[model samples]
Target: MSNLFVKDIVVSYSGLPIIDRLNISIPDHKITTIIGPNGCGKSTLLKTIARILKTDRGAVFLDGKAIQQLSTKKVAKRMAILPQSSEVPPGLTIFELVSYGRFPHQRGLGTLKLEDLKQIDWAIQVTGLSELKDRPVVALSGGQRQRVWIAMALAQDTDILILDEPTTYLDLAHQLDILLLLEKLNKEEERTIIMVLHDLNLASRFSHNMIAMKEGSIVAEGPPSKVMTSSTIQKVFDIDANLTICPFSTNPILHSYQLSGCTQDLLENANEG
Candidate 1:
């Protein structure tokens, strides 16, 4: 198992810091979720940790070696990152797209070795994409397309997987589908998973560790029981919410949110009049 560490990392945009001296440690073989409101630097931190964005200061280390010092192909062989959005090539089949993951492992002439072929097949099967292997990338539903991307990541055969909002733009059912698939990969295969998630409830239920951030700094970090308090929610998201234990997972769940200055008060006053 490989562990990732971020130490005092700073990422800036246009000379302003988006991720300001952020420090975090992702546990090996566990699911860690970064949660924060929009523009709070959750996704920026994830991308920086994955080495997609250059840090203005400090470093990210994978298994004690600075990530920037490693070769790109070397890092690709150990960790895979699925960004929030990607462009699909026209006329690319699902299998063809997934097979591209073997690029880092290919020798001269770029033939798929036997082990690589087996890994590709296993990735498709695990992601439930066998039936759609021959389908064109542009022809699939949103959920299926997301699975195709995950299959490609799985085909990379890396120990660590980093995703930015994997369930974004999906309906409730598709969101659950993607979360369940990631859960299975974490539990069954013991893969180290890190992602930025928008839904606090889903993050609480599925994550072994949750890091809550506000303005590029972490407000809390721990299991749901420790991190999902009402005070923390209010601090991190600027919303008043009630926290309760979930029945099935026994994790902290957000029971309700009270939006400040909502029109309900006006409606009540009008009714009284």
Candidate 2:
């Protein structure tokens, strides 16, 4: 499968730029997490990469072609995105919702072909929602609902999955529930997983690669040990942090953090830069 990457891309919102000529290549079959402070363009980058938002300049290339040049159905077959917030119509059954993912693969009046049923069944089974597939999505817990959405994406049968803040609004345990599922998808299915995450610790623990952004620019990008340094944390979020290796995973962990003394000054300097 071809990898997704952006080159010198500029993205704007409401006449203001959020990402300025940024570039990055997503490694195939790996879990990459984008981390940054609020308003730092993490979600903007993900949306642009997923083709949910347009870029003002340069290109987002997926499957070795400029994404904008491809049709929606063509793109959907190669990559799937789970946005930060999705509104599900009330009373929709989990099976019904996941069935929507088959739309990209549908043809000739959108009939549910045998292949479509197989994929849907696989998605529901892997997400551990087999028994609840007939239940209404509105009746499920937050974690279960998240799994339902993931099942929808999985049903898409794409090589790449881009998620914006996948763990937002989820409690601590549910957060792991989602991330662990993503990890499993990467390791077992060899799917490329990219996401925006606010929780630094979880991101560090789960991500094979991490990108740290500050004010619309990347401050650092690498494996957890390289990107989760005290300097990068302070520069990106204006928070002084203590870092150590996670003995179990051998990834860097944020031991503790507090506001940096030069928070205001760093912000001012970065804005000026």
Model 2, range 111-197, lDDT digits (tens) per residue? 898999999999999999999999999999888888899999999999899888888889998898899899999998899999999
Model 2 ranges off by over 4 Å: 262-273
Clashing pairs in 1: none
Q: Any residue pairs clashing in model 2, and if so which?
A: none
Candidate 2 lDDT for residue 190: 94
Candidate RMSDs in Å, in order, are 2.3, 5.4
Candidate 1 regions off by >4 Å? 260-273
* Candidate 1 clash figure, as a count: 0
User: lDDT per residue, candidate 1, 166-252, as tens digits?
Assistant: 999899999999999999999998999999999999999999999999999999998989999988988888777878888878999
TM-scores of the models, in the order given: 0.94, 0.93
Q: In candidate 1, residue 8 scores what lDDT?
A: 90
lDDT of 2 at 169: 88
